[model samples]
Target: MKQQNNTKTALIYAVDLLAIRPYSTQQLITKLKRKEYAPEEIQEAINRLTARHYLDDTDLCQRQYQAYINEKHRSIKAIKYKLMEKGFSQSDIQNAQEETDIDEIDYEYTVCLRLLNSRYIPSKSDKLKCQGYLYRKGFNYSAIRLAIEDFFYNP
Candidate 1:
């Protein structure tokens, strides 16, 4: 009966995820485990979902990347981090990110302006803080430098 219950639970979980939106195999497994599913059950459910076309990693990657692009405030590095956090593999991140064709801008400058406009005038200490924040937000060194330049351009 325990096995049966697990199966039913997995099915319910799958249905819930599908009803909300599509997901990737790894993403679904991670979510199911979060909800206390057994590994075997989660794997079975993931396989079922994949067979039913409710979970396709490629499609999910494209959709997610496109959504971020449409939102327009994200840099590629940040998008890659988001995908990684969502349990995407390196290959998946590379593939999905490549599909994104946004013009690369100075991420630092862009984010710095956002920070400054929000009234975050940076002193030396604040500069360090902002740098850390951008790093955590997944901006590359180049982008972060551009923002710092803007912040320090107070002549």
Candidate 2:
């Protein structure tokens, strides 16, 4: 049947996509939909993949969070926003954060200080520019203020 063929094709396409990199279930669904696959076919494909344990938002979210923190040194806000943009549910992102057991503010403060030390020059004129740069990098006002103080006074 044509429907059966389409379902098989959808599953094949989904598998090929997964072979390249991990995708959230929603992301995979969107891709299939974009390809003009029927909604039923896409859902069937998604269900099959999930049953195979090939699509797990929780696992992906945790790994992504770890990479953002340990490898990219992304701020907590940036990590959450990035993961959300990648189609992870908010609860999954929160669970990943909790499992990581890192104090968000303190970790961000340390990263902020490190960035400032590496890239910023301490001068009255440059201070404002530096603050703006850190803010743009997803550091909150509290972390930015504290890091700037520590960078200037304690250093």
Candidate 3:
């Protein structure tokens, strides 16, 4: 009876957290552990959430991927790291990428262009600085070069 009560409490806490935002299984487990819940209780809560369809890592990955791409405009590498930090496995991340049909080169070019035009204009006489900024944003050398060329030549 005591163990069952603990499990129920843990499940309620987990549900409350999920009501705020989605969490990966690992993330939720970590959070529950930090709350001093027993590992078995945490696992039980997670299992219940999963069984009830209240927790789906794949769906979370897909939603996060779309948000990063469409809203944050993050580079693929950056997004990958973010997903990893959020407790997504490499296989899950890869699956999300495949489902999203992201074209790396095109995405980099577009992001670079947007960054150049909006944040780092070539007309500022800081072409190298602009390149460095894009590099820090996880764009590759080739994509940065092409974006710079496209910006200066076309504009």
- lDDT (tens digit, per residue) of candidate 1 on 14-89: 7898798776677777677777777787777777777888777877887887787666566667777787788777
Worst 10 residues of 1 by lDDT: 1-10
Rank ordering of all candidates by TM-score, starting from the highest: 3, 2, 1
The digit string of per-residue lDDT tens for model 3 on 1-155 reads 13343445788999999999889998999888777787787888989999999999998998898888886477889999999999998988998888997677888899989888888555665778888888999987888899989987788
Full-model lDDT for every candidate = 0.70, 0.86, 0.85
**Model 2, runs deviating above 4 Å:** 1-8, 123-125
Per-prediction TM-score = 0.70, 0.87, 0.89
- Write candidate 2's Cα lDDT for 26-123 as tens digits: 89988888788878888888999999999999999999898888954678988999999999999999999999977877888999998988886665
Prediction RMSDs, each to the true structure? 3.7, 2.9, 2.9
In model 1, where do residues sit more than 4 Å from their true spots?
A: 4-9, 33-41, 69-75, 122-129, 152-155
In model 2, what are the clashing residue pairs, if there are any?
Answer: none
Clashes of each: 3, 0, 0
